[model samples]
Target: MVMVMVVMGETATPAHAEPAAAGSLEADGNDEVLTSKFTYYSGRTLADPSKTMIFSGNGNVPLAEDIAKYLGVSLGNMNVSSFADGECSIKVNENIRGKHVILVQSTCPPSVNDSLMELLLMISTMRRSSAKTITVVMPYCGYARSDMKRGRERSPIAARDIMTMIETMGADRLVCVDMHSGQMQGFLSPAVPSDNITAIKVGALYFAEKMVNVPDSASEDAPRRNVVVVAPDEKAVSRAKEFWNVLIEKGVPEARFAMVLRKPNLEEQERKEQPQSAAAVSATSVDTDPSTALEHEIVGDEEAIADCDAIIVQDIIDSGQSMSNAASALKAGGARNVYGFATHGLFSRDALERIDRAPLDHVVVSNTASHPIGYEDKPTDKITWISIAPLLAEVLRIISEKESLNPVFRLPKEQQ
Candidate 1:
């Protein structure tokens, strides 16, 4: 009895209940039970499965262990050590010849080099071992923002170069989470399927839970909070709408709706102008879908949030630059309480401190990008962590089953 692992797609089916997972695939006249064993640990990558073998890797052994546990698979072991000259050695103890492999690695700050090199080597090792397919799941996608950076001396196509490198490493597929800009996907040669999953659903659920006070719970000291879904800039308008959708689902009436719009991405901003010269390069379409590259512009109804409850800010990071600025404007505009939610908490360069000083009551983020241990130094008064693993797990199931992903996308809104 062999269990089948499936990667899910946008049209994947929903997992209604957690089946009593069988270690080995066994069928009792039920096709669902036939594949009873869990196959995916879940993050945000939406892919489909075709009864394939999925081997997980992320450079670090612990994270790989976590993924294995969630997938209900025997954890694959690895041996990695350094030499006196600071070089690294690697050994994967899995016989993965012709196996469909998934190497999970989030290139966070210090671990970027190690993770990249290890993942590359692991893929190469698997390739040499004759694995059938390789998919690299880089959760944070560190250099993603660099794809659209405005600089002259540096390469105008750094992000695309990274995409090229990943493909050259023998990856059959690539999946990254909410990129700084969706257009970053344009660099690839389309040899593989690259999916960008949104953390908005995760962010929505976080805000819905933390901000418990509604009109009924509003006291004199704590009047019904005004929940405004604010996007720091135009890029976040879609994410803000996601937050707004959650607010509506959480029993908030239609009147309590509003979103802060940001300036659109002008063609000039997307241009790569050579310093001291008039040469400018137009930004290429970053997504397989041509329509996605267009700038985001959300124009909510005028009565949106006319009698609001609270503001739910949705984003991937605060960085104190965008979220802080939006908080300032919301405070000045007389927002009752400014609460926020992001997927990845990359609080670099005193971002947490600046958020602490801002007019915010709470900020929710998921542990999908970085672990919660690092945020202990940040002010705890307004910070909260939501475990998105469950949601991610469900999404993984749907993708593997070839079912629709819309149901899971709607679940976070239901939590509201």
Candidate 2:
């Protein structure tokens, strides 16, 4: 939907009134930065001309628009609404028959269930309309936290359940951002084409330009450098390594890397010690402890974290517990600056509050998940939001060309 806002006529027009030309940045004598166009195409014609269509689901339309802009395309017309009984309804205004359709949606807060249901319905509609292929571009997978099952739990793995529903609803392919677990990628059935694109490169570029203070002549094994990449826990080693690799590509050779190990917090241990009947345990009582549920220990390169800037890298920051613990531990280990990067910032209840009390200088997250209202209004808070649209657009453009996504990761030439 195009924005229609009332503006006073005769207001002074800015120098950037005209759109910038594609693939260039202009500056009006150091006064303002004007971008002619933000795009990700590689000058390749579509394999099937006019056969590619992009649609926006109910959630996060602004992000979808950004992606469309990156592709130099407009969003396909679609009317999405609800019935009186809370049932989802949709009407496609453009012809998508026999077309390669990409539906952009992020199952984030406010109404995850409704957003997911609408996405499923849209896929089914497109499939019934003879769409050649339907790809669901979900930046934030809603049930990702429940990717694994607990001991003796009777319920199905929610992440798998969501994937099964999408595949069964006639979706031909799926594209998602940083998921909860890499193992979740294996759960996809053999027929469905899936890709778990990440924003680590995006975050690394930001840190390299704005945060890195490394020297150019440093060696690759400079483990005791000024800036260090940290994995909040063992589970995040791979993510931290990816960020480190991108930083290296961006010319931060002195940047080092480390990983943290977590031990259960005192409060969590106490709760575990208390005996409870099966009925009480089944009630899912909430733990009210304000402290992090875990304590961090530097498991790799302890010397690298001593008296240096530390950047914690992780895929998801749900409760911010592990982040909080890692920040405290890094500070206690004599780290001068503590920053964090999480691809998806779920920031569930009191997560911001917890981060406020932690020793972190800034927690940078991508716009894969929506920010809560007033998140930036706090007097002493540091939460930065980055856009993952360009990365998504690049991947989508590659997929549309029937090309492999291996180049996005800077893989070896033979692999590509």
TM-scores of the models, in the order given: 0.68, 0.79
Q: Tens digit of lDDT per residue, candidate 1, span 121-190?
A: 7677777878787767666676666675464445555667777878887877776667667787766766
Model 2, span 211-301: residue lDDT tens = 5733323574544347789988888888899999877766678788887787756886787668878777644332333344235578767
User: Candidate 1 regions off by >4 Å?
Assistant: 1-66, 82-88, 149-154, 209-213, 216-225, 255-314, 372-381, 398-416
**C-alpha lDDT (0 to 100) for residue 388 of candidate 2:** 68
Query: Model 1: how large is the Cα RMSD against the reference?
Result: 12.1
User: Which residues of candidate 2, in runs, are more than 4 Å off?
Assistant: 1-49, 213-225, 264-294, 376-381, 411-416
**Against the true structure, whose TM-score is highest?**
2
Report lDDT (CA) for all predictions.
0.53, 0.72
Task: Give candidate 2's root-mean-square deviation (CA, Å).
Answer: 7.2
